[model samples]
Target: MSGHVIAIDGGGTSCRAALADAEGRVLGRGKRGSANIFTTSDTIGENIAAAAREAVCDAGLEGLPLKSIPAFLGLAGINVGERQRELAKALPFADTKFVHDGVIALQGALGDEDGVIAILGTGSVYLSRAGGVSRSIGGWGFAIGDQASGAVIGRALLQQALLAHDGVREHTPLSRAVMKRFEGNPEAMVEFAQQTARPADYGAFAPLMFEHDEKGDVLARDILLDAVRDITMALDAIVFEGCERLCLLGGLAGEYRKRLSPRHSAILQEPRGDALSGAVQLALRAFPPQAVGENG
Candidate 1:
């Protein structure tokens, strides 16, 4: 493990790290709390360091100096504003490339081949690659973006319930079910939605949307269909750009694959690997065996 590198999938719920040698073989893995630059930038460096240390220890390479090792971090919201610079400045590793989490996802899934990735978890983001060019769409965090995301679905479900309560919309079984979670108290729902809910907190309601959709609930179907529209549009943009291979990632991936417009079904295929795998690929490319030297 002389020329080992760290590959990190810096996510909203957890930071996952993998220790890999110059050849891109993973030797160990580690996980820690959220590494979101948008919401948890203060702790990302600490979390990443801890996770990398854990990975090194897991690989029985605790004697190595982490500061000298190269690392590739794939993080969410890195493309927005100055977040990338702020993170790059704060990173513990001097040899590191901090990129959009979607970059790693695309690499993991496609391995440098032209393709598209739509990650539809607590938050959502879409990325595409073609002819060595990378492009991304919609990763603005939960407040304004994250379309087709679990958090968005959950928040929308709650909104529907509130709308029904106010006579702004018809009360459906799905809406009633949501209201019931708050003990039928509109005020309680308001308090949670407006004050206490994080993206993950709102994303907690996504499974319920799926469950109700299966039962043919009107509100659930409506909300899910709307979310699918967002995903479909993103897919369309990339596919039209000449990316024929498509891989959907995250919690809502399967459900969305089954529901997307039939036009995309033929291009959909399974991923070869995940974001961490892609990180290792990037790390290996950045520091090859010849570059690192065989003896470290």
Candidate 2:
């Protein structure tokens, strides 16, 4: 068995990896592009390996062979299909475990304590753990679900831009700005959203929405209002009666928190750590490091 462990927290937006010793001390970290199995499965293995390679090289451990390492990959879109299993087979790790991205987010948010986590990133998912059992609420991804995700929010903005352009709706400043990005051509938005855009591509527009929201742009307010409703519905389903912890995670987490109702505010709090931290902890437990020397 490899004495060293590799931990990954990958999603539609990016893949992050950490190299740690047996004692779970992080030596180096690396980041790469999307690892979403649903849309990017063809390159999932490559992205994972590339991130791992970068981590090792970042730590100046290029001398250690990756094929001998054990890895834990917490990836997005693993629940929708069998692609994760196939992707794992192509990875360089000697032993690897696959889990839904929400699993690691939950672990990072609540640790061993039973609680709930709503990951609101480029994609979204909700998970709750209680009484030694865990359950998932939603996370169907962009094609079908992911209602409260950045991708969804951004797509809605562009779609609204088209609505404004066509005179179906009043064009707010936010809509005008969106149209400007497309060079005032609705066809460009169509081509991008329909032909070439991935979830991250849409998600890239999320920050602009948030920025516009802060300025009290009517279009931004409307979009976030709808997204928050989706978040509330999911939270209501996943939060149990005795739930003590409720953590909002991912890139849009804090933004959503500001918009959500105060109903669960008492339980809502910051996570002790992040997904990568949880991955490292799990890695050390599952594959205990041997006496630290040349990665054993």
Candidate 3:
């Protein structure tokens, strides 16, 4: 169709695309590999294009020229203006808007309403909107920030494991298990860490902390509590920013909900939609009927 919209949600782990009509009816969907600007910038264009093409084909529009599609991409690591501009120029779509992944998440979660959202996944970011003013707290990526994120939790687990090995910290089943994963060899752990320093690599260990926490592992519980504290701090900041509504998004949201205080939890609301839906919303706004020369 002339006014088809292609919405993309791109992150460190995977990229998802959905084809939709002007009325916001979804037609088809597709998925592909990582599209994080910092991690996959070299191939992000190819990845986005591939996902869009697949989505179009899935919509039974295999012969459609992609340049006719208006797209919105909400991507991780695109907060850098230069990177956003560069990637926008490289994409194959006729018209496209590049926004921080958090923007789409906020749009999807709150629509036109005012609120705050904390995204806790392989990374974390806090975004809030009030009186048409948008403010962000974190999401500096895994290295310096992203507290309460899976990557942070996972990295903490590894650090505790090493500390336990050195007798600098109390040992626990969780640490022992982590050490066992490296065959009780600290050198092996070091080698692995050196080879796999990416946030996704560290985030792979996050589930192990949860698993051990359920078993009452002290270290694991401590790590989780630390993460919770970080998340709570961000929530407090959002509240101070005048946002009364909060929505938690991403893989770890549920885990965090249970750990949050009742006061904070009370503010949490279900998201109105997802990032892809928000992207479709953006596409519709950016390429309205008049812009597309479409008659009613």
Question: Which candidate achieves the best TM-score against the true structure?
Answer: 2
Q: Against the hidden true structure, what lDDT does model 2 obtain?
A: 0.89
How many clashes in each candidate?
0, 0, 0
Backbone clashes in model 3, listed as residue pairs:
none
Lowest lDDT 10-residue stretch of candidate 3: 287-296
lDDT winner, 1 or 3 = 3
Model 3, range 1-296, lDDT digits (tens) per residue?
47788999998778999998878788989999988898778999999999999999999988888898888899987875588788888998988888888998899999988999999998899998898778888888887888988888988899999999999999999999999999999999998887857888888888889888989999999999889988888888876545578899988888887899887888889999998888888778877745445545
Alpha carbon lDDT of residue 53, candidate 1?
A: 90
Worst 10 residues of 1 by lDDT: 287-296
Global Cα lDDT for candidate 1? 0.86
Show model 1 residue runs off by greater than 4 Å.
none
| lDDT per residue (tens digit) for residues 1-296 in model 2 | 55779999998889999998877889999999998888887788889999999999998999888998899988998887668668878999978998888888888888899999999999999999999699997789898889979889989999899999999999988999999999999899999999999988999999999999999999999999999988988889999988988999989988888888888777898998999988888888777765556443
Clashes of 1: 0
- Name model 3 segments beyond 4 Å from true: 240-242, 291-296
Residues 202-288, candidate 1: write the lDDT tens digits. Answer: 998998889989999999999998998888887777674555788889878988888988878878889999999999998788767
Please list all clashing residue pairs in model 1, or write none if there are none: none
List ranges where model 2 is wrong by over 4 Å. Answer: 289-296
